[model samples]
Target: MSMFAHTETNARSRLPGGKALGGLLQRLGLGGRGLVIAIPTLWLLLFFLIPFLVVAKISLSEAAIARPPYLPIWEWDDGLLNINLNFGNYLFLLEDPLYLSAYLESIKIAGISTLIALLIGYPMAYLIARSPENQRNILLMLVVLPFWTSFLLRVYAWIGFLKANGIINNFLLWTGIIDEPLIMLQTDFAVYVGIVYSYLPFMILPLYANLVKLDQSYIEASADLGARPVTTFLTVTLPLSASGIIAGCMLVFIPAVGEFVIPALLGGPDTLMIGRVLWDEFFSNRDWPIASAVAIVMLFVLVIPIMMLRKAQAVEEGAS
Candidate 1:
């Protein structure tokens, strides 16, 4: 036996069930390395894959109010090793214009929010990248500090700051800016602020990491070639930092599409985000089938952007 396999067999012998499995693997010459990989693969299949499959199965079933979900999901007529499925929930999804519009709006909002984060984060990242190493750590820490707080707590804090009788309104009133408090909280403005604040760290870190690795020589080389700042940035800096921009945008945009807390806390009733709608379907209505359909749709919606980001990142990496 190989040293590695021998070592793994000896170690596995100390454990209970592992000894038998390890001996079998040793006989098959897949003792350590294969087991290490197989264990995680099996774990993911059990925990993640099985749950997701269950949800998908439930999504395809008719809406039910009963206590238990069945094995076949659609019809549990057959005792075992049998299944029945339907597409009624997805058809219902097709008929709902409100749900469709919410999905589109969610995409637009996430896209715009990600762009805003990129615009703001890029400069701060650049500054941090250019800073002295000692100072860079401090600046990066400051950028990351807010992330230490609970995400829901941050959204709640926005409520206190943007509410009619809250900090901003009170300050404005005290300064005689208005006769009454502005209705800022539970508005789109509040939603945007909450989204931006919650996701800023995700935006900044990737950009900072990417920008810091970039040599100063490129920028200096462009300057030496008589390229103006704007020209150099457009030609060189932007292209080089393309991966960072893509990374940061994806990190924020994907989650923001499915964001429930910020919208629930900071948005008006009029702002009908899909996340809130999905939440209501599962919790308030107890409609698991429709909820599953919503989840499947959300998953489908997210796949497009994720694919786009992955393609962009791969291209950027290839170019680098």
Candidate 2:
């Protein structure tokens, strides 16, 4: 009754010669819930769905000498629309061992990088989460301080540090650790280092968020039960933070899979990734159709991990 009275009063409070906004919204079939849902639906349709459709269309087309450099898959002839899709692009990708190797190598690199990030980030996140309240903020700020610098600048800075005559080598040489400078730049080592450095924060932040909210009573109960720290962590803390691990791994792995700059700049000729292949096909070879196909394939490849993450999240939510 009170809600009804409030609604009636709201409807009656419109300015002179003004339509009731709530009634107008109701007439357009857009209540609060409807507006919230419709806005995001329209946004996805306009952006993601539409762009994916464009890419899918181009992927079905053939390479041409025209300005856009790709032939349309659909055409009108004799007042009838005709569809002519060239599946050769996909066929070519299947037949090419290079694309297959690149895709596999990309997955391998991303997976390895994600694991390394997790190994390094988990301890840091744990420390921060367990830190005294007075010092936690400062530690967290330190963890995130690297982001204040430009990412490109940070990557370039690593080049200076990893080069043959770079700071690392100079320091080592001065200390008589080695006579020759280490071959760090333009190697798989450099690529791994770059990926770990760049994505470490991504891994840490999620783990911290998960860890900070963990119940201390669980740890205390395990201690009272005479469990060692390692056992307690493995049996209790680790299980509780599984969601963070999944979240962090997904965050690091997804972007790392499609990373171009890190591999292009820090990796050697042997370190061929799908991202580099896509870049070469599009800009270097001017094969827009093939590039679109590569992109589509990459999108499909990423879908599995994304679905797994979603499933994990759903299970976690249900359990909670």
Query: What tens-digit string does per-residue lDDT give for candidate 1 at 1-320?
Result: 59999999788777889767768878997778877888899999999999988888888777654675322453334564445677888888889897898898788778888888888899999999999999999999999998997877878888889988999989999999999998998887778888888999999998888888888899999999999999998999999888888888998999999989888989999887889889998889888888888998999999977987787678656656
Looking at candidate 1, the ten consecutive residues that score lowest on lDDT are: 68-77
| Whole-model lDDT values for every prediction | 0.85, 0.92
Residue 67 in model 2: lDDT: 88
Q: Candidate 2 regions off by >4 Å? A: 1-40, 312-320
**What is candidate 2's TM-score against the reference?**
0.87
Name the runs in model 1 displaced over 4 angstroms: 1-22, 28-30, 69-71, 74-83, 311-320
Clashing pairs counted in every model: 0, 0
**What digit string (tens of lDDT, one per residue) describes model 2 on residues 1-320?**
99999998787775553457767887888978889999999999999899998999999999998989998788899999999989999999999999999999999999999999999999999999999999999999998999888888888889999999999999999999999999999999999999999989989988888889899999999999999999999999999999888988998999999999999989999999999999999889999999999999999999988887787667556655
**Model 1 reaches what TM-score against the true structure?**
0.87
List TM-score per model, in order. Answer: 0.87, 0.87
